[model samples]
Target: MKTPLSRLGNSGLETSLLGLGTVKFGRNAGVKYPSAFELPDDKSLASLLSLAADLGINVLDTAPAYGSSEERLGQLLKGQRHDWIISTKTGETFDGKNSAFDFSAEATRQSVERSLKRLKTDYLDIVMVHSDGNDLELIERNEVIATLDQLKQEGKIRQTGFSGKTLEGALAALKQVDMLMLTYNLREHREGEAIDQANHLGKGVYIKKAFASGHLVSGSGEEGQLSSFRHILGKAGISSIIVGTINPDHLKQNVRALCQASAGMV
Candidate 1:
């Protein structure tokens, strides 16, 4: 059976319960994964994406900070642009060794424009602020959110959101953006209240680090994954869990776990 889809808040978008994260697709440096690995070749990525589609995965999460991910996705996904919903980030950029942040309206607009060109799309399904752990200050400034609103009006982005580390920032973002991405998994449930609030307000919530940065996935087994998935996705407000993996078998395993999780929910 295919993975089920649900309303991502009220943005008029429906996303699979599992979203493919493209961080490993673009960059492997300065990451927090359990192990280090080489970047997959183009042929490998193509096959992985093909498998993702076969498994009914529709959402692709990428970021400008993720090295060449946006450009590569633009090339890899050419001609099938409308088939997948692409979510990219702004407000942060990585230069192999370090990352920088600039949330001025000018910088955010430039970032979105560059993302459109890199993704080879005229508009984005979702664009989020790549918070630099300074979520509260950024949200208070309102520069990034304002630019995203202008882009939405100009048909450059379908929805605006924030991927932040702090609860304070998450709550503030929930009030303004159509979507929210926060770290929520079996190990960490600090963002639970924010998830409920976002759901109550009819806003979409996307989960990050659901597998605890792959720490929990190592020896958990499928049954363990099913339990974790149920715990994370069982919440009322979670729109999807963003998992980044280049392994085809792992992808299929996640989908299977998701299907089982959904069944358990019913």
Candidate 2:
């Protein structure tokens, strides 16, 4: 089944209900997923993207901290740029062995510029500030949101947002940006109120770690995955759920699960 598109709040952008997360595409050294894995080769990566596109999944999430993900996608999606909605992050960088964050206005600008070159795109659909658990501090101390806003105005990015961890940070981000990428899975729901608020305000809310970072899987197999998808995607506030599974079969299962989950809701 093909994933359907939905309006991303008031950003005037439309993305699929399921977004493919690309962390495993570039960095696997210090990830927090269930297990360590190897990065896909160019051919495998191209195949995965092709399957996603054929399934009608439009959004792809990447970040500077995700190592070479942006560059690889830039190369693979060369002639198919318009086929996907690219969502990447700023404020964090990975140097193969470690991650360093800089939320300064200058850094934010430089990060977006670098991402543009790496992704081989003239304008990004959405640019989110990757929070390091210090959501509020990142917004107030640095030019993270402001720089994104400027970029939006300059037409470099269509929208600005924050992938925050705390409720307060999410709320603050709601007031200043077009979207909020928050963690709201079976294991955590503290951001529930924030999600509702974003819905009411017409701001996009994309869910991260909807399966609790791969720890919420149950013996129900595909049914378990469908349940998790229903729990979050069934909510009216969510724009999309970002799942990072490199295995094509897993990706197909996720899309099918989402289809079943949404179907059951009706």
Candidate 3:
């Protein structure tokens, strides 16, 4: 069966229930430990994206903070841009030297413009306010929301969201965001109530670290532990789970687990 595509809040954009995270594509920084998987350059990245598209995964999530990920995705997916739903983030500036938060209205506008140039797209399906689970006050400020609203009007972003680490941040953002991205695996269900609230409000919810930073997946030293956690998320009402892997076989395995979870076979 074809995977279902659902609307994000009242936005006209529809995305698959699963998304691909590109945080590892261009660079790896701030991660607690270095990844053993060989990082893909431009060509390999394109091939992987093509594979993902063939597998019925439509939503691709990337960010400026992810090294050269956004630029690489732009170069690789330029031809197939219309074939997928592309979601990216803003609210921060990266100079290859240091990164700093900038949620002001002007900064947000400039960020989206830069994203458009980097993605080589006229518009984005969704643009999230990239947050580190802190900065509640900045996120709630009228300037940021107003700028996002303006971008929505200009057709630069179809919908806006916030990627938060805390339930309180998510809750505070629910009033203005069309969707939310959070860490919501079996072990991190502290946002259960927030997920319920979003679902009730008809806002889309996207899960990150669903595998607990590869802990739930096999070969990460934590196997068989994910089944129960997967069960919990499937039953708890999550919209989509974004997991990253470098191996094609492992990607297929992840998809299988997702299929099983969707079929209530987990």
Candidate 4:
């Protein structure tokens, strides 16, 4: 099957409509709350990433908060750097033991430098401010925006964005961002207002938590809930929906959901 790709905001970077999320690579989000469908080891991760690139999945989202996900992804995709698009986050620094949220200019700069080292890349396709709602204002402050702009100018980051929990928080930084990653799924639809605002501003919208953290896929409730959710979001004009799973079967199932939802449209 041919995967569809779309331009991110006004940037030249084009990504698959369904991106691979790397939150489960290194961290154990607990045994009860699995990060993705299948938790592959280092070897498996490398193979899966290579397969994803062959399948034309360009965008891969990761963060420092997701355990050693960024580092693992970097190592796995080391030789295949130019084969895919890498999207990562900053605003928080982790040193294996401690994590401190710092949106200051100096911190942001340091964060990107660390991310670059971890990803084994000179420049990132997109760098998002991973703010947890409370730091929305700090993300929008001149220092933060100026730092991101500088990174773009320096060719260290192609574009800048943010991941917010609320529509208001996303909107607060819309003017300074080229993309917005937020939760918009079947069970959680409150982000529609912010998505509309982002679209109007010509910002790319990358939907996260699209299945409500795997609730729709577990089959504990409605049977066609996942399909319905994808259909609704596709009709609503969302650019992409990221569904991650470590299990290949489950990953294919998620792709099936997307296929069924957009059967006629695509």
Clash tally, candidates in order: 0, 0, 0, 5
Q: List model 2 lDDT by residue over 33-145, tens digit each.
A: 87778899999999999999999899999999998999999999999998888999999998999889999999999999999999999999989999999988888888788
Pairs of colliding residues, candidate 1: none
Taken over the whole model, the C-alpha lDDT of each candidate is 0.89, 0.88, 0.72, 0.73
Better of 2 and 4 by TM-score: 2
Question: If candidate 2 were superposed on the true structure by all CA atoms, what would the RMSD be?
Answer: 1.3
All models, RMSD in angstroms: 1.1, 1.3, 2.7, 2.8
Ranking, TM-score, top scorer first? 1, 2, 3, 4
Number of clashes found in candidate 1: 0
Off by over 4 Å in 1: 264-266
Model 3 weakest 10-residue run by lDDT: 220-229
Candidate 4 local lDDT, 61-140, one digit each (tens): 88877778888888888688887778888886555566668778887898899889998999988899888567556655
What is the full ranking by lDDT, best candidate first? 1, 2, 4, 3
Per-candidate TM equals 0.97, 0.96, 0.89, 0.88
Residue-by-residue lDDT tens digits, candidate 3, 78-180: 6788987777888765565667887888878888888899989999888888885464777766377678888999888887888877888888888888888
Report the lDDT tens digits of candidate 1 across residue range 174-203.
888989999988889887888999999999
- Top model by lDDT, which number? 1
Candidate 2 TM-score to native: 0.96
Name the lDDT value of residue 178 in candidate 4. Answer: 86
Clash pairs, candidate 4, are 37-245, 37-246, 37-247, 38-246, 38-247
